[model samples]
Target chain A: MRTKNQKIRDFVLSAISVIVLIALWCAVSTSKPDFFPTPMATIERLVKLFEKPIMKVSIWGHIFASLKRVLFAIGASIIIGVGLGLIMGWNKKVRAAIYPIIMTLRPIPPIAWIPLIILLFGVGEFPKVLLVFIGSVFPILLNTISAVSMVDDMYLKVGKVYKANTWQTLHHIVFPASMPTILAGIKIAISSGWMVVVAAEMLASKSGLGFLITRGRDSYDVALIMVAMILIGIVGAALSIVFSFIERRLCGWMSS
Target chain B: MASKDIKVQVNHLTKKFGDLLVLDDISFNINKGEFVCIVGPTGCGKTTFLNLLTRLIEPTSGEILIDGKPADPHVHNISFVFQEPSAFPWLTAQQNIEYGLKIKKKSSEEIKSQVDKIIGLLGLEKFRNAYPHEMSVSMEQRVVIGRAFALNPDLLLMDEPYGQMDIKMRYYLEDEVIRLWKATGSTVLFITHNLEEAVYLAERVLILSNKPAKIKAEKKVDLPRPRSVSDDKFVEIRKDITDMIKWW
Candidate 1:
């Protein structure tokens, strides 16, 4: 059904877009030769990383350490954020009481909490976990609240007329109806959370991609620094792709 | 749970929207198996009455009774088909119809049989797996009606269920509803602004006054079964009701 000319046009457009992007990256990266590496150099560093041995502690060690932190942090975010969001959305009293505190806290950036988190939890996994949780939880919570609030009142009435108890109604009506927005919030949380992990780990963790970047900078090893940067982009892309696949499979019903 | 004559008694049902009264001390009795239509002008509290019946909103100063028993939403077999095609967009037509059955804890086989019967009866076999977004407005309305009827409720409340449809589709759905009503014998209290639809569908039509609405008139259509709009008597009654709605 697709026209040959249209496909050719699309291909050319994609190729041009990539060429322009690479050219722009080359321009920016090459401007400061001592401080920045070229696109080709970064690719070379990435290829070198692949040739290295895989183990619990190698170049991949930092990757694993960062991944662990991100996963745990995201898990905590989902539990606390989604639970509170649902409560705030479902109950007016809960929303009124908790919303002011959340608003007061939300304006402060996640990185700003590093000092306080380190102060309370000490410079360990707890601080990093807390930072990621703080970074990711609000988006999920706020989105869930709005999503649940926006659900058509008719569905709830339908639930009531069917004599659905509180738990059943929440499961059958509110959750499913609010899923699309919740998923969107999770998506935003995830990408932002990944970005935060690197920054958090750079500041604190001794064995993470961010730590690797810091180590590279301290040693003045530009190749390793570029490798870490490349890795961050790759990991972010991979997370989005994986989450999107799961979302599509689970929520195909919602689109129709 | 016994199959006996049940009367839905509304006693001094007064409703207000802040300072503006919507239903002014309205009262009525809907007999078991009777189909009554409440016809009124815009903002005449017809919807408020239906909402009160389903307890979507509590009456400002009254209670609804089923026979001698007080109205209980948890125990009452009451279902609604709204003016908007209110089928859950995520669920297929079949699933929407099966929703009430599932919630009521019907056996799978029973649910299957009932769903199949309703789908076949409503000529919705081809569209059973289609979600609400994939359907035309009329098709979505059919799904809504089928879902309501699947429960086999003791009383069915419809709030302008056909007002959104085109004229041809409305007539077709109206006929379908009448057929279903005859087959199931459920008591129906329909709220509509359309005088023609009220006359065509109901055994008795209750007319309400404008704004601070109250029951202005009630007319029993003793016309024969499968009433025709083209019939002279049907036209006469329709005209009278139209004038009442237009003026009052």
Candidate 2:
């Protein structure tokens, strides 16, 4: 079919573009060998990193540590954020009371809260998770609020005409209508969560991808830092791919 | 017509937005299992009338009575199919059809049987498992209509359900709607700007004036079932309604 052929062509085009980017990186690195690590050298270092341990954990161990923190934070944020967002969207009184406070807190960068968070929770997993939670929760909450408010009034009328109760209307109509936008917010939240977790780990942590990079910087191991950086990019991309797959499955109707 | 019981009675239904009245002292009675089409000029508050009937909006002064009591969606089984396709995109065709039954807390077996029957009736069996995005526009509207009819509502309200479709699809869906209406024996009040569609579908066509929409005229179409638009009688009825709807 034409679509299949077009998909294959698209794949090939994207592969070629990536290859060109790598070739450009190779050329630039060759010209400044002392400062920049070549793509080959970085790949070699990445493979070598698996054999050894950084801060008493291997590369996979560090990835797991970061993953554990980010996933926990994102999970908690989703539960709290979605619940609060839906309630706020449905109830004008609640929205009037809480939205102003949320708006005030949302603009401050998660990193700016490091000192206060550290002072309260210490340099433990709790503080790092909280930092990521702060970074991710607002976008998810705000997006959910907007999505809930923007659900077509026509759909609500359908619910009403069916004699659907308030609970049924929210469950059946409002929730699904808001899903695509909420999924988009989750995508954004994941990336922001990743960034915040790295910054938190780099500031005060012993075993994470972020700490691996910071440790490399402290010890002047540029190749090790590059390895950690590349791994972080790959992991972030993989997470995004997972979210996109879920979004496609859940929100297939929007695309059509 | 004299023997048929009145299913819906609108008594002095008036709606005003601030100083501007949209509907003025509208009173009508729809007979049990009757198919009635309302036609009016563009922006003549035709939808406002339907909305007030469904209580999507409250009337300034009026009452919509069903079965000798004030109409309440909670107390009555009412379904509405909007002009635009209102199928829930997240649900498959089968699930969309089952939505009302599920909301009413019907048993799983009941839901399945009802959904299966409606899907078959709508000719959506081929696309029952397909999501809204996977189907064509007309097919999506079929799903929407199927969802409404599956509830076997006491009253079914449609607001120009085929206004967006081409002539071919419109004719096909119009027939499908007629089939569904006859099979279910539900009282239907369909609103449209298309006079031919009104004449084709309704047993009686209600014509409304410009702003502050009131019933200007009501024409009875005594044509037999499966009526033809090309028939001389159909054209004459369509022409009569068209002339009544003209503002200038």
Candidate 3:
């Protein structure tokens, strides 16, 4: 009962906060017309963006391009990272051999690998996707390794007493026990992958939301830049909402 | 006892954790289809004793035999209920009960029938689909107990499975365990610190000394089924065991 009331209060508070933010933006824009674009001007620019191509494509086309790169990168990262992580976590020999390399690579920012990735794959779709993959894979892999390695010994003992083979134990016990942590890792990976894709596009892409921002800056169209920024924010927020919903569904056991 | 009737035999079982000795030269025998409870003082290495018997921890020196052969989990069907709640959080009550049978590669139809029987016997029909986190502590323990009994294991080892529950719930689950044991006819080795629980549940109660635990006394209770705590024999047996292990 209390939670229902709290939920309503939380929703009302969030809505009021957004309204206040937009009102502040509008007030600031009125005072400095040339420097800051008003909320109306940004919304108008966003609508006009759909009518005409900003960089050889419509707004949705740019969004789809960015979305495609991020989704592919994240998908590949989850598959490869989770597989390698489980192996590394389960086997001492593999963990000793591979964990050092991962630790050394993980600290370096993904943007720092942009030049090398471009040289290796060329300035096409591969480089952008690779950068996003590099950005996302480490977090997912590290979290999976920890999750699998730190599984409660009690659960393993349960498996042992049940006469479960190693494969059965892994599939039935370890995998399910680590799922909540793995889902958390996936959430982190998606946002990180999204950010890397934008940075990669800003540096080299001919079409994408990042490219739209760059084009707007080159033309000194502040409203257009604001529009792109707003779209990026909205898309990022939407992705997060989708991931949270998935987490709640899949890991409901963790919470309740 | 006849060799064929001895389901479990622990010969000079000892366990040492590095420099620290936990179980000291413990030897016991459990007959086929017997309900035995091991009672000791708090932290008297009861869990270590169960773990050694279940082969979760290797014995420093000794042998655990089941049916005249070395006890191997791979060859024998052994189920354990830990002191803590051991239900899988991801699975519902019914699914947890099916876990052991599934591991044994039983047919799907057989698994369903066994699960249905255990769930019904445990009176978990209403909370059949509830996950571990969604259920109360007693219910979670019931799921764990149901999971262990579903396999009809050769030996069922329980380590204070109801230590965290209230007296009412503990007595209720203890009765349920007795019902399951009678119905399934599996050999049971239950370890707990509660003397009343031992007298109430076991045909034979093994008492242990504190620390480096060794069997101090063994009392046989020939009382009839559904013995009450207030009964003369039950109270006498509970008092005798309680006095045997009295530290304070």
TM-score per candidate, chains pooled: 0.90, 0.91, 0.94
lDDT of 2: 0.90
Q: What's the i-RMS of each model?
A: 1.6, 1.3, 1.1
- Return the top candidate by DockQ: 3
Q: How would you encode candidate 1's per-residue C-alpha lDDT over A122-179 as one tens digit per residue?
A: 8899889788888899899999999999989989888877777888788888998998
- Model 2: which residue pairs collide? none
RMSD of model 2, in Å?
A: 2.8
- Cα deviation in Å at residue B177, candidate 1? 0.8
Clashes of 1: 0
Off by over 4 Å in 1: A1-11, A24-35, A53-61, A254-256, B1-6, B16-21, B60-62, B243-246
* Sliding window of 10 residues with minimal summed lDDT for model 2 chain B: B239-248
User: Which candidate number would show the highest TM-score if scored against the true structure?
Assistant: 3
Candidate 3 wrong stretches, greater than 4 Å: A1-9, A31-35, B17-21, B246-248
Q: Name the better of 1 and 3 by lDDT.
A: 3
Per-residue accuracy of model 3 over B42-150 as CA lDDT, tens digit each: 8778878877778878899999999989999888888999989999999988989999999899999999999999988998899988889888889899999999999
In model 2, the runs with Cα more than 4 Å from the true position are: A1-44, B1-4, B232-248
Clashing pairs in 1: none
